[model samples]
Target: MTRPIAYPSGSWPPRMPADLAAAYCGEASVDVFLRQVKAGSYPQPVVKQGRRQIWAKADLDRAIQPTPDHDIAADVALDL
Candidate 1:
């Protein structure tokens, strides 16, 4: 298993774990998150410090929220 990324509070550079990508994107796969980022379907994470990729928890929360055009009924059907 891959190790989780850790970020210190008030740290200049922030890093997020692959699991966070799964939680944010509703898909437990880092590859999927990377694909979404490449496709512009998801918000890009900020790169702070030297090479750390940081995603704000608030930003991730907003990104995961259902949009106005989301088809709730369709999602429910798909879940079944």
Candidate 2:
């Protein structure tokens, strides 16, 4: 059996799957998250602890931000 660590360090960031799921479109679906991970759509994992992926919360949050130009272009295409 193995004991759990609280990840009391800045380097650790947030590695919980729930946090990752939330950062990924506010959905808690691990299946979709894993697919995105494989598709290289999510932020790169900062660290690999055993079999766990340590995702930087800031970086993960950044992935969801849409560029202004992309949104404007979409609006233009839609004539909105």
Candidate 3:
């Protein structure tokens, strides 16, 4: 089985699939979480930044737990 990604502490880079299997994806496998990611229902797999791929913290938050003020229509605009 694949190891679960640990939740980061404070301003940590929003990389890796967190413990969202049960929290967000409703399944108990990171595979399911990953599927959501693949389907764009969860955090994106990667973001291009010249020669680097950065996971935008904002995108991660909006994916798992969308803010009330966040416009649903504009939800698809990934900072990718």
Clashes of each: 0, 0, 0
TM-score of structure candidate 2:
0.53
Which candidate has the highest lDDT of all? 1
CA shift of 6, model 1, Å: 12
Q: Return the candidate ranking by lDDT, descending.
A: 1, 2, 3
Give the TM-score (vs. native) of candidate 1. 0.59
- Summed over model 2, clashes come to 0
RMSD of 3: 9.3
Question: Clashes in model 1: which pairs?
Answer: none
User: Each candidate: what lDDT?
Assistant: 0.60, 0.56, 0.54
Q: Which ten residues in a row have the lowest lDDT in candidate 3?
A: 16-25
Q: CA shift at 38, candidate 2, in angstroms?
A: 1.3
Tens digits of lDDT, candidate 3, 1-80: 86454444553554533453223334446656666667877655465556444455566666667578977567455422
Q: Give model 1's clash tally.
A: 0
lDDT by residue (1-80, candidate 2, tens digit) is 32222323444335554344443444335555656777877766777667776676777768767776557566457644
When 1 and 2 are scored with lDDT, the better candidate is: 1
| Model 1 Cα lDDT, one tens digit per residue, 1-80 | 44443334553323365456545556546666766777876667765556555666556667768898998788678757
Looking at model 2, report the run of 10 residues with the lowest lDDT sum.
1-10
